[model samples]
Structures are given as C-alpha cells and as structure tokens.
Target: MSAGANWAGSHTYSAPAFVEPTSVDELQQIVASTDHVRALGSRHSFNDLADTPGTLIGTSKLPHSVEVIDEDTIAVAPWMKYGEIASALKPLGLALHNLASLPHISVAGAIATGTHGSGDRNSNLANAVAGLTFITADGSIRELQPVDDEFDGAVVSIGALGVLTSVSLDVEPAFEVRQDLWEGLSWDALLANLDTVTAAAYSVSVFTTWVGESAGTVWLKQTVPGRVRGELFDATRAAVDLHPLPEIDASPTTQQRGVPGLWSDRLPHFRMEFTPSNGEEIQTEYLVPRVNAVAALTAVRSLADRIEPLLLISELRTMQADSLWLSGAYDTDCLNIHFTWKRMPAEVAAILPTIEELLLPLGARPHWGKWFAAGHASLKPLYPRFDDFRALALEWDPTGKFRNEYLARTLDLS
Candidate 1:
C-alpha cells in the first residue's frame, strides 16, 4: 500500500519509504539497519506524529496474532485494531475495560496517544495496558511490565523511544451495553451539571455545534442491567439512532435505542466496518483537570462565535486520572474538549494558540495525536515528569534513530 494520508486525510506521511516487514525478525532487521525509522500503525492519527524523516515501517505485515496470556489479560499484535482484537476476545468471553470513540485505531497507536472513550470513571485506553514489548533503537527487543520504573514513560512514548510490537491489556468477563441518544440540553444546564450528566452512563459523550444555544446531542452507553435511561434534566432520549454529527447519516453509527448488545458493539460510536466521524475533518483536543471543567467550558464558549464558523462539531467527555508520564490525564481526572474541525489548516492553526492560552492555565494538556500549536517549551510545564521522559527517550535512542520533526518539536530533541 502507498503511504497515503492519515485516516482524517489531514496528514500525508512524508517518510522517504514505506515498507511492511513480513515478521518480527524482519521488522527487527529493518530497524537495525535504518538510521531513522518509525512504526506506522493504522494511520488514524490526525497529526504528523506518525511521520518519520527516514523509512516508515508498517506493522500490518508483522504478526497479527492474539495470544491469550491469562484469564485477566491477553497479548495482541500492536498493529491490530481494537475492533479486530475485541472480536477475538468476545468469543472467549473476555472484554477490554474501554475502547476509544472509534475502534479502527490500532492498539499501539491508541495507547501511544492515550486515546480514550467516554466515561467519568473510565481511564484512557493506555491505562488498560498491563505490559508492552518493543524493538528498541539498537534492535533489541525489550519487555516491560507496568511495575517497571520506566513503564509509565514507555506507555505513551509517541514513537519517540522505539517501535512497539505487542501490547498486553487487562480484560474482564464479557458484558453487554445499551447505548441511548439524547438531545437538546441547554448550554447552561450542561456546564452546571457536567459531572452528573457524565456519571449517568457507563460512558457518555455530549456533542454540540456551539452555534446553537444547547448541546446538540448526548449519547449514553450504559452497561446492561443499568438504569441510566429516559429524560435527563430536560434532555430526552432520542427516539431513533443518531450520529454524533447531526448532518451525517446515522447508519454508520453503532446500534442504539437502548437495545442491549455486546460491549464490542456498543461502546464505540462508529461501527468497525464504517469510516468514523466525517472522515474529512481535522481534530484538536485538550484534557483539563475535572476541577476546572466548568470554568474552562465557560471560557471557551466566549470563543464560540469564532470557533463554530471553522468547526464541524465539538465533543465533551471525561477520563479518570492515570499515572502515565505523557498522558493528558497524567495526574488528574480530566474533562476532554475535542473539536472535529472542518479541514481548514491555516484557520485552525491560527485559532489554537488562543485556545491553548485559555486552557493551559487551567491545567490542560493537548492530546498527543491531535493537532496543536503548542511546542515542547509550553507543553513541558504541563507534565511534571516530562524531563524524565525526555531523558528516557534519549537513553534508549541515544543516536536519535526514531527522532523526527514531531518528536524534535514536541520533545525539544537535539
């Protein structure tokens, strides 16, 4: 396959070459001989994080096996999509704690970016990782458990340290979920009771155009045998299936209307077989501490007139705190503010600094895989252990074999 644009068509990887190694042994050989290389997962990232100055190694040609480690966990190929992995686990009566908004993203890619699904109690996807195995810059395969001192930094490496090969994630007994859609919660009511609204479901997402005075859509994914249904604060359950983007057709969305189904089928908004979101949008997201969610929203709403014109829609979700060094939710529970903007690069770039300035003081961190104007200097202060992560990256790849424009700019790499 040609090295094409990313899933959002926002970033066309600029690597000199794109190759798919047939096996782990071959993958290692490629890494050992290349001066600089980067692993290309499902190409779901909206930014240039996946691009490399040298060769781009596609993981699809490597092993796609799913090895059952134990009753509580399983090891999966880094290239496998969450939807593909979930299919293998479901038949065996196992399930992951959460999936991202779309399941088409690869296991390694999602974990590297700290991607997440919605839920006040749910942590981002990387938190589910119990162990990781990767090919270091020196061509040595290294295994790391969550207990390792450097494990936290390794989990969300952003392809700075090495090329991840396999990831083991904690799993639970299979469970079912029922997704329901609700609409029209006034902007005031949403900001006032954001926590209560999120806690209403196993996972929930509130979407809006901001041009309107109220939330345009609210999706509630409730685990089977739960009661988070019906009217909620004047937001009534949608009588039919709906897409997060109101203009888009709902057929691509996962089954809804409170019909209970396997977790694999309901947790994600888009069905595995369908393209997610608009497929023509660029994304930007910031995760702020829960304590400042309301204030942050209020601050951003002041820019609604400015934002809505260039925006497609915005989503609000929650994530529990995690210990991963580069994770947006590193030290605090976060409320995610994501914009799926119309593919207008210059316009989005011009507006980002203002958003960052308003939210950064509120303890916001930009999502690693999305578009953001913040460079390493501004981002360094957000993560307390950033210097340590930088030290770790340099220690593993002292020659900077994996370093690229994205890492150089984001990590301030020499």
Candidate 2:
C-alpha cells in the first residue's frame, strides 16, 4: 500500500492496497474486492475527499480520448487534463466556455468539486457537462443526461456516488482570446467597473495584495475576431507583461509552448505562474451573490488595514449560476474572492473567521475543495438542494463503500 498527499499538503491517508487501474474492468475488480474504495485523480484536492482507508485507485493511467460527436459537442474521458482537452479541441475549432485557473486538474476531479474560472457570463466547469458515464457501486456503467432528474445531483458528486469514467461536454467553435493585464486602480474603481470590465472581455480577474492599495495587475481576456492585429491590444499586452500582478510571472515554457502553463496544471487557487515570496502560503476563496460583489469587496477592502501586510495576493472574479448540486454557483450568480496569506497558517486562521463574518451577510458560499470554516450545517442554506443531493448519494452508494471522514463531515453522509 502507498500513501499520497494532496496539493495543499493538508491531508494524507494510508491504503492497504494502492492500485493504478488502466481499464474500467480493473477498477471494478478492485472496488468489488475491497471493503473501502476511492478513486483518486491528480491528488489536487486540498481536502480529504480522495483519502480512503482501504484501497486507493489512481485513475492517472486511465485512457483519455476526445471524440467530436458533432460541431457543438465532444466526448472526453474523466482522466483527461483540461489543457490536453483544450489542445485537442483547438484543431477542431472548438473551445470550452470556461476553464479553471489551472488546466492540469482532471475532468472528474474538477467536476466532482465544481471548479470554475472568472467571468460574470461564464458558468462552473460542470455546467458545461451535458452527460456523464460512471461505474455505479453495483459495477454497472451508466450514462446520464441533462433530462434525467438525477442529472443535477450527479454532476458534482464529490466522488461519493461512484467512479466517473467519462463525460460529454457542450462546446463552441474555437475562438481567439486576447489577455490584457493592467493595474493601479482603487478598490472602489474596480468594484464600480467590474461589470463593465468583465463584459468587455470574455473573462476578467483582478489581482491585488490584501494589504495597502491595489497593485497594478488586473488581468482581462477578451474574445477577438480571428487573430488580433493591432497596436492597442499589443500595448495592453505590453503593460501586462511589464507590471504583472505581484505573483504571476509571464514566462514561456517548452512544455506548454511558452504560454503560462502553471494556470492549467496546478490547484485551482494555486494556478498563477508568478512566483511570490517563498514564505508559507495558504488560500481561502469565497463565492457570494453577484449583485453583492461590489458591496462585499468594499467590506473586505475596508478591513485592509488588518489584512494587507499579512497577505500575499487577493483575487476578484465572477461566474454565472449553474445547476450542478453542491456547486458554489448553484442557483446564483457568483462573485469569487480569493486570498493568499504569507506562510502564516495561525495568522490566516485567526483572520479567516473575521473575513467570513463580513461576507456571510452577503450569502457567501465557500469553495468545497478549498480551505474554509463552514461545515454541513452552513452548507445547507447555501445549497437549497442539499438534501436532494444526499438522497441521490444514498441511492448510488447505499453500502457506504465510498464514504470517508471528509465526505461524512462535509456531506453529513452517515
């Protein structure tokens, strides 16, 4: 048996047998013979969802295939990395509607935890899923579609229901995106202009240090017609290159053809490529009602006096509501606020409660896979269909074979 740790190095567990199953049949055999079984991806989760006391099955060896079913759709394996999928789709003139900061997260892992990116007009990664294929506890491979009542509950199952093997996603023709970076705007200016700024681009994000005034790195992504040819866009690109948000270094690499590969390969919150100070760093992200974004950001900025020096970076982003159960975007437009602290877990732990207290009034929902103080009780109100999802989980894994301490505590699964 082998033990593995997650990205944050916060959780680890022992498995009597650690198996890498390259095929579905092998996975089924392992699960059928083991008392407790859990499927693991890239081990990117900060939480303990992937930890199991029995057999740990790593799906990294699973085959990843992308097939163009139609001009607007594609079928992909759950093991596929976001960047690999993007590269495959690019030649076909297709693209995902939204992508998490990093492209390295596995399809199943991202969908399991409801990962997302910034854009008031965009939705969670699971929202793009039109169908899913999984091996249920009974060893039957079932396919689900949007029309099924279980659709909403199954998309973001948190790896509790069963092992998801593949997914069918809705896609669009490939489009050219121009990323622009700038800074030097006040919190108020950003809040006031967020809607406009996001609308001007396909996606947008503001990166600032939690302390002091806003630093000069606001990243913007705008869809352009074909290849962008102009000095204006070039100048904006230059500005971004010159004064990158504090932590993100925009350098080319051989692995990703020179584009910032970090964004597509690391944990969602740790996706930025720029290397900041090498102190201990911890992260917490909150998603609140879109309408309250400006107000909520203002509230955090007001507490900047207490937050700034201890912080490394604060990111502001947005996404549309999604139907996936347990999704932060469940039934509400979301404004994401992320904070990175300078290697002081104790100080971060101390101030987090205060930050949550300030944003809770705005209906903040913590990211399931990130650090937060909220438990199942706090999760209920945020996810209206919480009970329904629990019921679905019970139906899928009645024997409690996939149950773990993290799943039990977070989902209140018996």
**Pick by lDDT: which candidate is best?**
1
What TM-score quantifies how close candidate 2 is to the native fold? 0.87
> Model 1: per-residue lDDT, tens digit, 1-414?
458778788888899888999988999999999998999889888899988888999887777889999999899898999999999997899999998888898999999899999898899999999999989999999999988999999999998889888899999999999998888888878877788898989998989887667867888899989886557887877887788886678999899998899999999999999888897889999999999999889888989999998898899999999899999999899999999999899999999999998999998999999999999999999999999999999999999999999988888975
lDDT of 1: 0.90
Per-candidate clashes come to 0, 12
Please give, for residues 1-414, the per-residue lDDT of candidate 2 as tens digits: 576666556556666678898887888787777778888877666657787767888888877799988887899988887878877886676788878776667888989888888777789898989899988877778899999989989998888888887799999866555555555655555655667655655566777775555433556665554233232221133333422226445452112111332223311322334322232456678998888888888888778888887877777788898778788888899889987666566787788779888887788988777777777886677788999998998998898888887777877986
Candidate 1 residue 222 Cα shift, in angstroms, is: 0.6
Q: After superposition, how far is residue 322 of candidate 1 from its true place, in Å?
A: 0.9
Runs in model 2 deviating more than 4 A are 14-16, 226-248, 252-280
What lDDT score belongs to each candidate, Candidate 1 first?
Answer: 0.90, 0.73
Between which residue pairs do clashes occur in model 1?
A: none
Q: Which ten residues in a row have the lowest lDDT in candidate 2?
A: 253-262
Candidate 1's C-alpha runs over 4 A off are none
Q: How many clashing pairs in candidate 1?
A: 0
Worst 10 residues of 1 by lDDT: 228-237
